[model samples]
Target: MDVTSDEVEMETAPVSADELVEAMRQAADDAGFDLEPEQLEVARRLGSLAVGEASVPAHLYLWGAAGRGKTWLLDAYFQALPTERKRRVHFHSFFRALHRSIHEHRTAAAEAARATGEPGAGARAAAGAVANAVDRAVEDLLDEVDLVLFDEFHVHDPGDGTLMIRLLEALFSRDVSLITSSNYPPSGLLPDPVYHHIFEPGIAVIEANMTVVELAGDTDHRRSSAVQRRQGFSRGTWMLTGQEADDELADLGLPRPDAADAVTMAISGHEFRASAARGGVLWFTSAELLERPTSVGDYLAWAAEYDRWVLDALPAPEHLTREARARFVHLIDALCDLDVELHVIAATDRETFMTAETLGRGGFARDAFRTRSRLALLRTVG
Candidate 1:
């Protein structure tokens, strides 16, 4: 991923982060959005830092309320950058892949050691194996990318929080530049005060490694944009959980899922049972979709095939486990990304759904925030 000097010069010549952001402001205005002063300030700072040609580029942590254009700004900066060794990814997907790679390496090493019939791969040896595996995995995962742009970064699970420290340390060691957008500030991450200390190391690393820019605008750009450009996303419903939900289904000419005739789909040679399937429409319960250890890959596969999805009985996150909440976020993200016509039936109404107790708790906030932000674009009918 070579950063051609000519290209760099063209983008960074004299244009500062401030200037670039101002340009973005004008563009937004042209698109009927009045950019806030705070957004412009943050963008200016980001633009200036982004032009550095140092070996280890300065990193940035952009944080603010949801829908303040943090992602929009970072996206513009990412595209304008002259480097070919850049990757922009959703934080959840990136970490999932990271964990998967580490697990694969560690498991393979352990299996190989066991198969070799060698004695004394004891606890200490196992620890060493894990460390070595992590090193290799980090290297492999970041082999070519010099700049990684993570959208909606947050840590809730202790395992993920702990891993963040290691990941930050590893990335710093390799001099990899990072640009992440989040709804939390450096001090505000992992906001559960009881578990906040668990991520101290990661937080410290972030503070030392990146410049923090807070985008504290009052308006949510996505919500406003949705209202202004509220087309394309249509045929959605916010229905009641039981009888009314069934009635809505009937109104839409959808059949009730039969227990005796469950529909199943296969992905990667593994069978995944669905509540119901008809034509290209699929039905799933919140429990089946979120309670299971489903990956984004599963949703991606389904999204590719299904034109319509009916997610029924979404229990407000209180009853859901942490993993379930995370999966729900991933599910919504996948469907939104694929632009699937989504019809949902929940115990609660749309107003209360986004700010549910579970969504506001722990690291789920960022994902929930993003889910809600994207949901704003969706057309809703009661």
Candidate 2:
């Protein structure tokens, strides 16, 4: 266990399919998950296909409920592969990168058109530039990468769904293999009946080209007993004087403020500040602590940098309108995705306010309320 840096590097070898599956099993066991036989079989088959000689298919879809090890399986498989052969990214980050690439391509194309005698060619040039950018991004992503693993692959907007289709079409043409995990199957994605047709072709391609695996089990490995222990509870209030808190933060290896107005701290690699509170509360909101659309790297950084977080407020379920509540719920869900411990020292006990009746009154079903309550408990206490 005491692996030196050199020894650690030496120990890292390309993981075989069997090794990958075994590692998944071990991780499941460690997290107190009881894998069903079917789940195990899927893992074995996925490992085999991933390591097989055949060129990877256009797509591979693994869909199941939250905490069913869909993400875990894909992550384990990706980690097992040779580093150069894989790129694991959340769908949002990938889309943002793709969008930026498209923008750059369009800008270049515009510049080129401006320099040439081509009038009215700007639009066509821009379109071609976008296509090329998409192609190049897909190519770079697929370059040397035998498999691409995308986690939380869900389309909430029409624009995103269209972009996904185009991206997949390009990747498929190039024969780049894709493995994606989602809460719902391809057909169920973007559940609006109106836009279902738009998503149909993409879903058909996914179904035809990729093996569908479902790990239908009640146990959420992320919330398993062992994981709970590792994550620890987020509770208690650290009531220290302004100066005391500042000094303690420095002692704990966090940034200390020499002036009260400006407080500098880094969360997930992006540095931002909470204007020092006039009351010396130095309150932290989940929004302030977790910038929206955070990356896995950012999550890891936040987890390592802060063992315990003191928050003055958490967005309450009742205070938000339906859409707003859903967004906040999604945000909390994302926080759980990061697995960071949160310690809330709020003025009000928001925990007690999340009740079945309150949720019912708020227009949420009892079961939905219960699920959200459980997740909230995990966020508040875990």
Whose lDDT is greatest here?
1
lDDT of 1 by residue, 34-111 (tens): 756787777677667743367667888898887788877776666666556666765554565555565666676667
lDDT of 2 by residue, 219-318 (tens): 6543454334434332222322344445545554443434555565565346756534333234355455433443443433344444444443444445
Q: Which 10 consecutive residues of model 2 have the lowest summed lDDT?
A: 1-10
lDDT of each: 0.70, 0.56
The positional error of residue 24 in candidate 1, measured at the CA in angstroms, is 2.5
Candidate 1 residue-wise lDDT at 152: 74
TM-score of each: 0.76, 0.67
lDDT of 1: 0.70
Residue 165, model 1: lDDT of: 81
Residue-pair clash count for candidate 1: 4
- Model 1 alpha-carbon drift over 4 Å, by segment: 1-19, 26-30, 120-137, 140-146, 224-237, 241-261, 265-272, 277-281, 291-308, 315-330, 333-341, 354-374
